[model samples]
Target chain A: MNNNQKLERGAEDIFGNWMQASMDFWNSMTGRHGGMFDPAGALAQAAQSSSDQAEKMWRSGNKMFQLWFSILGEPENLSSFAKGAEVLPGFMTQTVQQMWESFVEVHKQLLSRSTPLGQKAPASDFTQPDLNIFRTWKQIYQKEFQKFLNVPQLGLTRVYQERMQRFVDEANLFGTALAEFVRLFYVPIEKSLDIMQTKVEEMIEAGEFPEDPKELYLQWIKVLEGHYTTLLKSPQYTQVLNNMLQNLVKFRNARNELIYDALGNIPIPTNRDMDELYQEIYQLKKKVRELSRKLEAKSN
Target chain B: MNPPKIAVDLILKKLAEDTEKVRIRAQKASEVLLSPLNTDIATTPHDVVYQEDRIKLKHYKPAEVRYSTPLLVVYALINRETMLDLQPERSVVRTFLEHGLEVYMMDWGYPSRKDRYLTIDDHVNGYMDNVVDFIRARHQLPQINLMGICMGGSFSVMYAALHPEKIRNLIATVTPTNFDTDAGLLHVWTRDMDADTLVDSYGNMPGDIMNLGFLLLNPARLMIDKYMGFFENIDSKPFVENFIRMEKWIFDSPAVPGETFRQFIKDCYHQNLLIQSKMELDGKRVDLKNITMPLLNIYAKFDHLVPPRACELLTQKVGSQDVEDVCLETGHIGIYVSSKIQQQFAPKILDWLKARDGSAKTQAAGKKASGRRKSASKAKPAARSGAPATAS
Candidate 1:
């Protein structure tokens, strides 16, 4: 064969080989093969899992809202009623629907971009598509997040606004943290892909064809792991993790406040009263135990 | 002439092989994920000897009791005692029984909202001491063997120190008595944590929240690589079953009592008061120098939770002449569940207890030698025999 024909064949061969290697990587991700180094797939899975968890959380919160409304029977009859009580259920339902849709859309987008970016040719011009994904994520995040800020407050004004506002604010903080966590999978891919692109092109120029896709994959994982491990082991990461966790408490407290407020209107006892009783009983038990021991010592 | 080049064909061949390998792996993984897994963990047979509120004292009387001195196993409050008996073959309790030791375990069952006010003083001095007294009285013995694991080990240490006369021998495994070291992330995190806010919000610290902290401590390995390893070895029934059992144990964490948690984090973790002997419970100080009993402090070499430095200083601080500090080459959980660790450590404990048991057995022999020689001879032989099988 002529030199030009051989070159053409070589190009076809190179592209074909890269395609097969990419498919192998993809297979590893979808559980079609051993997922030794499938961080992106794992992140997608996490996002999907979190989406489901968030839905369950919303459902539970709605259940509390429904129970609150049912207990009152006639909201208008109450002497001191929460103004937001009327719209709270519908508001929560609408907010949850928006949140779910927005989250799923982001998840779908993440999965779509993940495979395409991973399958890109090493010799081709690599456009860091993470920028696009981030932009899309932010827009949806902001839109859905704004809905939380408008949480139908009980009794309006400042009575229940603190919790409602804090819950929304915590969501924003947590969302930011979760976004960074998900980006852990993407950043490494982008960085490693850029580096690998250079290595592959150089090898081509030198007429050296190394069948080291597996090695390349392994190196990428090492790089990814190294970056994450450093971040995870840092004091800064600890603070961030703590911040995220603390916000969860805030969110819970806000939700509980909403429930407890609604429960207050009725004659039934609440957690506050239960807590006081428990604390009192606990102190009495300790005191009784102490006194019994002292009496036994005296008798002896 | 150049030899025939087959670079393209070679790529195709590699692709074909890879595809087949991938297909095989995919099928195996699917089978694993879809198939029902029967991971029967913590299945050792035992009877509840005593009960108090939520707490139950379990006596695992072997088919034949080998040793007269009963060893009470106190597990960490974070996890269940089931960890020691995770599997039959790898059970520490079973290994101890085979060696002729009568074992009793304290099941500090799920602490409810009512238990939020329970403190460390209540656990170590009240519940633990009560259990010890009950065991001593039941057997009509002066002292019984005491063994603690992890946080339970810490409580055991405090108990042994305060009431050293009640314990014959003390064994602490993966226990962090010295909480001052910056050995683990838990230490660093808890040091700066807002414990007041946390305890106030949750009343009882949720196990799931504690789990998150532990998970984050080694997220790269524990979260990512470990799961990757699981996916790789999904086809192996033994591996999968072991993995699931471990999962159950890890997630089966109990909410720590708020008062107990508050004191532990503030005094032990934040203030580093335990080792300093500055920690106080119910107006009494916990002085480590008071622990003069025969002590066996066993810690894992590669344990991230309670690092070697966290446990290595126990022998130094403790006023025990017979303190044997054993460092097993494994992680925290691996110390109990790993066959190699169980084999190495269980035998060591048995041998140590046997030597201690010898002194007691000889005294009883001396006391009975003067009277009824015929009956005494038979009783002497019985005492000499390995754990005697009684009505279990």
Candidate 2:
């Protein structure tokens, strides 16, 4: 191997040994994982487990809605068939109304639950019934988010750890931006339910059925547009946007470092070298402008 | 007759009509995009008369010269100034020339990686001063008219202050002078930004990054609603052309020089130092009191980028007694490109300049080239290296 490869090998071994020894000490201290213990690590593991349980439990609540929907949707016994037929449509309408109310309640929670500046919203916030009304969607969103940032590679290798850490930070920023974007995108549709509910009731009272639901959808889009504008101009939106920008810069720097390392071995002038040349020429031009002005003054 | 059947039939008919309309619209949209329509903008004639590195000075000569004093236009570095000459009907340069005035504009040019070391001092004091001196000598006059746009206006204010005798009439359009304002979200966000880290990482502020920030400022209006409006108007030929022209202008952003971007954010924005006179260009303080010329401060009443409040404080802080502030009835870019404003904006400047036009008038008034001699009589043909004053 060449000197660079050897140096990297040396680094990997040293860092790998250090990490292994650190884990062993932590295990001995906490008396877990066969002498692999850090109370912080134990606590983190416990926290992760509990959070998984909570998210699963919270997501399962959708089954309750489904159960209620099915029970009311179909009668178990035929003895009450006449009443079932009479009450089914009204029950379905009421259920839809209740679902909308739940969504609005969740929206209020999202608006009210404020995180301190600089901290990401807790992961629990993502899995809440308020955020995820449907099962398995948040999980999919998170998986895709990771895929976008690239899969986390395993090992104590310096490059792997660095890339993983950078990607994790990027994922956090993307989560915030995507949440805000999706929220605004959902607002228009969520708002249609409200207008549709009202319009349906008015039609019933007037003894006329609303012919087109699409018209209500269009109106919802308009309402959503207005809310989206307000959200876009909000201070919170600006903060999130800045967070994304800063994270983007970090990601760019990481990529630059990796690319520069590879490019250093090649026989090509990099941006850094070009920048140096530019700095030199820029300074020279300034000097020339100053000198030219002086020469003109002297001639005069 | 069954009421349900009638309702169903009516709904289906309505849907069919809408579907047919949309299909026709989509067909037209495809054809428009596929077939190249004339997307021409900024077609007015001009020559690159002077060069300093990447910077170019363009002069647009008129068929008739009514005024003696030539006006120099300075545009902001954030975007190109092609918007001033967007089209035949809406060209600011053409309007000024038609009004019988000689016009020269400063093109900050596309700054590259080599431009990272270009400080604000280099632009305001060095290049601007050189250009001003060149113009003064060309006319063999003591002072000429100066007009600055957006950030360029801020630089002009600083330059005019340092060399007040060189400028007889000063026009500052849609420029931000006072940095302390909460009216714009950009102001609030920049106040807390770590500009040092940003400049260190990127060297130069990437235009794409800046454009993203701008889009986020009003995402619904700029990003979503704008495209939706375009979709609604996609079938209209004129609308499509205008939309593409605007899109071209919006995206043709240049990466700003690193040193200049860094100092602007730190001193002018984060520190709120410009209006306080705490800003130093090349170790010399930028005092607004020295801008005591016949000042015309033009600002857009509804400009979101540079709010009216951000610009209104200039006249209050300036030391000029003859300063007049005019609030135009449009946003920032619209003041130049809007059809209604195009008819009025250039003429307003023309009238203002004619009143104070006698300073550069010579025995050869109304001539193609005015009496010369303090320096070169004509704008020098640009050289390849962009070295300053090579034309002279």
Candidate 3:
């Protein structure tokens, strides 16, 4: 068998064993097998079951990687594959691997430095925060998995399958963009809270803290408004917002296309059909109104 | 780092006082909230004089008409025109009527899916022009006073420029003619928006989405502080009633037609074609120089949506020599609802219209009528002078 096929078979075997282990655990936990359930035993069994398959998977995966790298290494083969699939993702794997390491390191630092409430902590250092899990997921998916979605389909349902795949890919991208946009929106809140906490601590130290909760809320909101005003006007926030909106519109269009295709079989009319007819009617009415206005002016 | 040192006794005393205050206020607030409250808005007496395709003209007739020329007010399509008559005392419509000026307001009703194809030309040239013509024909006058608010102000500016011969006095309130300034978040955000794609996906721009955008512009204030204020003053019947009225008006948004939104975002916000007089409607350029009518352009100095820079350039660009600009110290909605600002807003418009009523005899009659109103108010208090005595 080819290295790719062998790798896929190994993956399927590993997945099957994992699913079997999960079913066994659930069945034991529910007492369906009428045994004293041992969670540790179930986990151990699951690990034991997949351990051999993992070795086979690793060997197959190594062979597949060698095959892909060999193909990507040759200038001639690279040009041929590049023309068809945009670019083979082999080139980005090294860069993504580096980024993933540094991303993990930065998050580790952040988690280590996090302080409890009522304690003096340094100002929030979101400047180098690696909060974009979606970016990592996208990179990994692109490097190892996205090509599966690009595979050509056979038979009469080829175009339908292609559209469905596109809809799913677009949805994933849109969701990632939305998450990033929401994270950017929360920056102001985070900064405001940090500042508010610091100021409140200072006030308490100086015996000037307001006793009224309402007054504290008013102060916090004022600071929050100030932070939001600055963040919203920033170029970074604007770009993130635009990206999210563009992604949303694209996702909606993809979804609409799928819906329209499905509606073609039903008796109901699609939005496209209605929109086309509406455009024609609108144009006709506009023309008639123009002509009647001209005729009325002439009569007057 | 050391923990914060707070005085226990101070906090305990304040907490005890606050708990008692909240307990008493909570009881009164519940009683007030449960009772029948008159939170209805736009309670002015008016008739639907005309309507065409989800559009209506509300004619608020005065007790005695002092001016031969009628005033037609066009409000923004983003929200309803009920904001003008939100409350009795702060009602701009009632204030105008009490001053002996006949008013006609345009209500661009909620748009449906079929209305998605409607464009700016359809609104300014088609709907607004038709309403103005209807009013002119009814009054048998060649020209009438035209006023626009916010987006409607921009439409009015376009209408006056296109059909200046039919407009005698033009008043633009909180209008955003120049859209290039980054003074407002809307201007900065809309500049990068793919309006065409948005309209293609969503047939019409939904109102709730626009409200969310507005709330995001000042989330700390609009989303949190405003609610806190409501909770703080929940025990006061007048405050609660007024707060509910405002909440109703703020959320009563109407979806803008797709084509109109696309064109507005592209032409006004992105390209800023209106102030430069390069904006086109139905192949006709909206040359601001065509607006030769006497212009009264008024805007709030503190308006975040349409800043002064956006509204201050029209008088300089328009062809009218008798253009007057008034910048009131208020926010966008405050110009219509603030008790202190409403006094200046309605009177200024009435005086401006009276001066430009085109005939000296009408001015004399209006002055005489105003003098009589002053004496009548002195003899007896105005019935709708302030908030109702009850929790309405």
Candidate 2 stretches with Cα past 4 Å from truth are: A1-222, B1-14, B359-392
lDDT of 2 by residue, A222-265 (tens): 65455545554556545555655576677667667666767878
Candidate 1 per-residue lDDT over residues B164-220, each given as its tens digit: 999988888888878777777567667678788788888899888788667766554
Per-prediction interface RMSD in Å: 4.0, 4.4, 1.7
Global Cα lDDT for candidate 3: 0.79
- Writing each residue's lDDT as its tens digit, candidate 2 over B328-389 gives 76666767777766656677778667766764453224222321111111212221110110
Model 1: residues with Cα > 4 Å off, grouped in runs = A1-158, A161-163, A166-225, A295-300, B1-15, B21-37, B358-392
Alpha-carbon deviation at A201 in model 2, angstroms: 7.4
How does each model score on TM-score?
0.69, 0.68, 0.78
Count of residue pairs whose backbone atoms collide, per candidate: 4, 4, 0
| Residue pairs of candidate 2 with colliding backbone atoms | A26-A37, A27-A35, A27-A36, A27-A37
Each prediction's RMSD over C-alphas, in Å, is 23.1, 20.8, 13.4
What DockQ do you compute for every candidate structure? 0.13, 0.18, 0.44
DockQ of 1: 0.13
Find the 10 residues in a row with the least total lDDT in model 2 chain A.
Answer: A120-129
lDDT of 1 at B44: 81
